[model samples]
Target chain A: MKKIAKMVCILVVSLVPTLGHGAFQAIGIIKSVEGEVYLISSSTEIQAVSNMKLISGDNIITGNDGSVGLIFKDDTVVSLGPNSQIEVQDFVFNPAEEKLSFAARLVRGTFSFITGQIAKLAPKKVKLTTPDATLGVRGTKFVVEVK
Target chain B: MNRSLRVLSFLILSSIVTVLTYSGCSKTTVVLLKDPEGKVGHLVVENEAGSVDITKENEATTIAGATSKPAAPKRYSEDKISSQFGEALNMLPTQPKHFILYFKSGSTELTDSSKAQIPDILKTIELRSSEDISVVGHTDTAGNSAYNMRLSQRRASVVRKLLIGEGVRADHIQSTSHGEANPLVKTADNVNEPKNRRVEVVVR
Candidate 1:
């Protein structure tokens, strides 16, 4: 059954330019980790670790007994419990310019989210998508479980 | 091949039975979200049942399950937000750490005790291999709303710089100002409250 989880294998060919002068490249950071976890970006799968950087469009997967926590540019905290996979579908934040956006897809497993500065600055811009539903946030703290 | 088709069948069947009649084989994906930052926002939840708007901070909304069109949204209190997702939260690591730092009246300066609290914060951060820190500023009701707004911004900026100076990654930290709107203690207009003149920090 796990074989059905086809990997998109994204090859971030678009070079990430320098910051401040352009769009902010990195959107999140791995704040914590336990057990088995991996980050599938482009066509690569990298083992997860504390402090690992996360960018938009990366698919994160965790094995049994594995959990990972992440923090975005807006201080939004999202932690994934064991045997789960989630994707950072979209993220955009530029306070000086008043531009903000956040969207994610929790494919399976459990993950808790605490709204970040992006939601507080722009609530309408925050959203979380699931297999059967789409969630809009108002600077909140809540968890999602997909069975 | 059979396994993948079975999974696909499950998805198709779930959608087909998503109407008024629900089947026992369907998978229910539950979603809960609460806004504890006290930011008043109109959040939209769209699904098979219809759509509902979410407003007010500390308030929460939940969708019972989704292998089909999800059930109608349900709202809950702040404390109930986590408990409502108890099954999911139980699988997570220890709860995130929260810290409250007090400020002087009408000033961005940290109080004596709060200043002392910085060391513990720094130590805790050092212990973690990875970190995302949030520093939010707030003010009491002693000044005009506009004035307090700017004051809160100044306070958050002051603390953000402090953390950055202490070696926290600048990009990983988020700083915000809530003015007098989100007070720890409710107070009448023009009333001063020490607890309200503070900063809230969360380390995840």
Candidate 2:
């Protein structure tokens, strides 16, 4: 019986990460889209639509007339302008465990960002990287353009 | 004659500075703006060369390259900014909304006044196409910590069921419990606080 109980404990511990939270959960949602926006994940590209859940590691690409808006679980808002590409590199918002992080990369084009709970709770953990420089956000609204 | 020369030189220098600031825009540029609440936060633009801090609204910095430092922040006109980033700025998502519902002590039942808010809550969830809702439960310090945790979980589930019955998708709702760890009103162990026994629903 003791051996069986130990095995059960190990199974539960291993399953914790894959539960309906953490890395398996949706990090944000596409709130608005215009023109020709596409979401690329796992080498698959799909036309972007409002209310679509987005996970980390997903790439958002826009055409010449495309624009998109997204809202993360922690209320962070990100918008991309025409002819833009951005990657959601990392995002973790687990307030209960005090594990908070937000990171993204803008390869080109224009971006608008508004800080959320993650930045307010742990400002240093938030980062927005561009080709030339990286922005360390401190709970603010900002815009970036990369030529 | 010297005074006039100084004024003329100042004008020339100012114009030159303006030209440099605006002309070097081929690289990455970051501009700080105020939030919807009219609050401006600071940002740090850093690279291998150095870092530039932006504090004021409409302040901007340009980074020429990875090896070069960020430029000193300069105030940009509203017209210039709108012309560059108007599309992105206009696409910002609406802010999330939060609602709190009080619960009866030691049970999954909601208070009378809180029950009356169900209609409004349902309306909020209905308005958003792919709305995501989080129902977090909390309890006052009126019981054992272990028991309180279980109680809060039940409370959260209760709210979750109510939303689902009202047409909210079960997959869109995430239910969790914080027990008495996060109390609206702090108190000693085993103290009963009505405000602390509540569930918070965030609609995004």
Which candidate tops DockQ?
2
Tell how far residue A112 is off in model 1, in angstroms. Answer: 1.1
**Residue-wise lDDT of candidate 2 within B81-166, one digit each (tens)?**
99999999999877777788999878899999999998988888778664678888889999899999999889989999999998
lDDT of 2 by residue, A8-125 (tens): 3322221111127455588888999999999998789999998888898999999999999999877789999999999999998765455678989998999998888778767898
DockQ of prediction 1: 0.20
Residue lDDT tens for model 1, A3-77: 211110000000111133333377767766788999998769999888777787899999987878776656677
**How close to the true structure is residue B19 of candidate 1, measured as C-alpha lDDT?**
40
User: What is candidate 1's local distance difference test score?
Assistant: 0.68
TM-score of chain A of 1: 0.82
| Chain B TM-score, candidates in order | 0.57, 0.78
In angstroms, give how far residue B162 of model 1 lies from its true place. 9.1
